[model samples]
Target: MKLLWLQGLACGGNTQSFLCAENPSVSEVLEGFEILFAPSITWDRYEEEVVFHVLKEEVELDVFILEGAVGDTRRICRRDFEDVVRELAHRARYVIALGNCAVFGNIPARYSREVKGLQFRFEKRGGFLGEGFTSRAGYPVINLSGCPAHPSWLSYVLLKILNGKRLELDDLGRPKELYAHLTHHGCTRNEYFEWKVEAEELGRKEGCLFYYFGCRGPMTHSSCNRILWNGVNSKTRAGMPCVGCTEYDFPRENMFKTEHAMGVPEELPLGVSKRGYILISGIAKTFAPERLKKRLIDEG
Candidate 1:
């Protein structure tokens, strides 16, 4: 299949991360799909030549992948990047939004009215492309949402398409198989969270970052802990809070501090009612195990 990749306003983190896919491996992916254009890797004098033919219907676009948000700031296809995305989306069989920027308009949309995601901006449905837009395959932009989406997730989607597997998607246009689970799943600190033990600081091996710290693992949908990054580590596992980069409400202020209302967390876990959270948390804190209460070894 022929794949054409494009970018708008971004740092190219997703491109860099996509190259690090260990399971499929970058070479394997390159071999499986004919990458017509990948800005980071393939840049010719007439860089966007394939793109022009694809737009003019001279070349067929099997898959169209956009790595960043679209906006008026960047020029492509004569005027703006959005113009190309809007046109190419109709010709491409499958359209993909490869990162938080392209899916939810992360940093770029936050600053300008012109910058926005493909189909949705933040929690709103209308973006650079209208909410009603769909590709030639009759699918909305398949979002692999993350600050820099996991390489395996992108590779998984590609492989699934290659194998002709049915991709069941959630309401958010993300594959249900991937986004159905929260980042909290398979976390090493689940026991600590279950017992209401909060990590006083970052990188404590035993404590959960959800309570005192602004860990969005409980609510954010991702397989970060399950699939793992670089096949080994994740942000929370490394003692950093999940910044909730995948969700629409990203770039939130004071990410390290959790917001509370009357001694209860303002952002409860997904599907957990506020009252339920309050009650369960109260009980869990009261009966937390002694083994978890004390540090295993004195660091003095």
Candidate 2:
């Protein structure tokens, strides 16, 4: 497969994440595909010409992966990146939006009036590529969404595509295998969450972040805990809130503080009703285990 990776309004965090893949190893994974152009890995400006040529249909484009938001032409340079993206997307056999910015116009779109994602802007469809756009394979943009998408998720999707397997994407175009489960699944803080124990501050290692720290693990769709970031830990495991980075409405207000209504969280877990959450939480808190309430470490 001939792969071309392009970047628009981005910080290059996704490229860094891809470089850190461990299970299959970055080199091993790259060996499988023919990399036509990747600006981050190679400091070559002329590669854009090759991409331009590919867009013109002079060469076959097996896969076209876009990172970052598709900014407006007026605000940018003489060349319109969105135009190039639209053209290349139609020519490629497969189109993959490699991060939240590319898939949902993430942080960049928050302030920019003209920036948009490849296929969707936040939850709304009709972005740079429009809602009707589809790759030659008859598939919409395969979104690997995150602040900086997990390396494993990118590799997994690529492997599946290379093997000629049909992907099952969610309503937002994310692979079901990576986005079906909540970030809370397989989390180490499940006990504390169930018992409504709140972590007053960061790095306490004994309480759930949901109650006070605004962890969105229970509501966000991600395999962060199950697959583990860097094959060892997730944001919640490392004492940080989930932040719902994978969701379209990421970077929500008051990230450190959970929004509540009458002392109850405004957003409960996926299927748990407000009344049901209150009922279960009350019972669980009343019978909380003594072991879980105390600090895991002994400072004395």
Candidate 3:
């Protein structure tokens, strides 16, 4: 299981997230397999004197994980990253994209004129592994997307590989095991959502933050509430709005404001109809309880 982990124009938060893995000391767990190299832990660079065993000796790869956005400039390190990604991608049995930046070009690529995400830019949609960029080994690139992907998501993917289970990936190449559900699933504030109890304040414990605070739990994918972060809580459970970090166009303009042209959302569910959505929302709100509408002064 020789693996290579590479980073491009990244902030290294994913690295930190990987290092903080609690399910297993990720390093110790992965030690059962050989690691060809890692950017942060390895001392190799363009100027380094380490022997390129993989390139020179023809070392086959088991997995390749790419992080960060791939720049669009002709003179930038994007080429270097792309070269390594392509070379390793073609040679590896699997490729894993470990963040939103790599999956859909997160924040930097949002409004930037040039830089693009690993496999896509905003308007372009398809990224480095172009619309047709597929692995020579027959497996598609695995995308683990999140602004900062939850640690467990990474570990679970690696473990699944170790156990030889078939990973069910989505259209975007994300694992269905982790992203098949929305962040709102199993949220403690679900009752408020069902009752249409909008939270007027930022940290209210008794109301849903989606209707007013731009929480995208209704639209965004991920199991934040179902799995529970750090084993005890999640964004919605702790009174923080679900920022829709798992989605591609996260950190949109005036993020606090919901994406609505009038009173209806501009973006509906994955493929749901606007009319059906409005009808269900209307019915849900109509059955709202007065007690849920009333604000609770003491959470305790």
Candidate 4:
């Protein structure tokens, strides 16, 4: 397969993440395809005219992987990038939006009106590519969304695509294998969450971050806990909140504090109703285990 990677308004965080992939390793993944263009690694190897020729359809493009926001403030620059992206997307058999920026215009989208994702802006449908757009394979944009998406997740998706397997995607175009479960699904603090034990401080290891801290694990869809970052631990496991980075409304305000209404959480878990959450929480707290309420170890 001939693979091309492009960037627009980005910080290259996803590229760093991809480079750090451990399970299959970056070289192993790249060995399966012909890398036509990768700005970070291959830009020096090829001339600008070569890239222009590829963009002009002089070469076959099997997979188009975009890793940043597309439209920016400059009308001419944005138009040029959009034109190239559209042409490549139309020619490629598969189109993959590699990170939150390319998938949903992430943090960059907040700064400029022109900055937009390849296929969707945040939760909105239309972006640089129309909502009805699809690649030559008849697949919608395959979104691997995150501030810096998990490395293994990227490798896994690529492996599946390489094997010619049809990926089942969620409504937002994320692969079901990676985004089907909530970030909290296998969280280590699940016991504390069940008992409504709030983590009073940033580094406490014995409490849930949902009650007080803005841990969006229960609602944010991603297999962070299940797959584990770096093949060992996740943010929630390391005493950090799940900031809902994979979701469209990421980088929300008050990341360390939960938003509440009348002492109840403003957003409950995926299907739990407000009344049910309140009732269940009340009952759970009333019957909270004695061991869970105390510190895990004594401080000298």
Best by lDDT: 2
Model 1 TM-score is 0.95
Candidate 1 at 190: error in angstroms? 0.5
> CA lDDT of each candidate?
0.86, 0.87, 0.75, 0.86
lDDT of 1 by residue, 16-122 (tens): 99988997797786677888888766756354677776766657787889988888656665856677778888888889999999998989888888788888888
Question: What TM-score, to 2 decimals, does candidate 2 have?
Answer: 0.95
Which ranking of candidates, highest lDDT first?
2, 1, 4, 3
| TM-score (all chains, Cα) for each model | 0.95, 0.95, 0.86, 0.95
Query: Candidate 3 — worst ten consecutive residues by lDDT sum?
Result: 43-52
Clashing pairs in 1: none
Q: Could you tally the backbone clashes for each prediction?
A: 0, 0, 3, 0
User: What is the TM-score of candidate 4?
Assistant: 0.95
Off by over 4 Å in 3: 39-51, 72-79, 111-114, 123-125, 259-262, 268-273, 277-280, 295-300
> Candidate 3 on 1-300: residue-level lDDT in tens?
877787766888898777767757777667667766666655455411222556556677788888887665222233354565567678888788888887888876864755566556643656777766666556567888887898889888888887787888887778999999999889988888877778878776788887767788878899888878777888888887888887777767666656676787676656669888789889888988888877667555
Model 2 per-residue lDDT tens digits across residues 165-258: 9899999999998999999999999989988888867977879999889999999999999999888999899889999999999879999788
Candidate 2: how large is its RMSD?
1.8
- Supply the global lDDT for candidate 4: 0.86
RMSD of model 3, in Å? 3.2
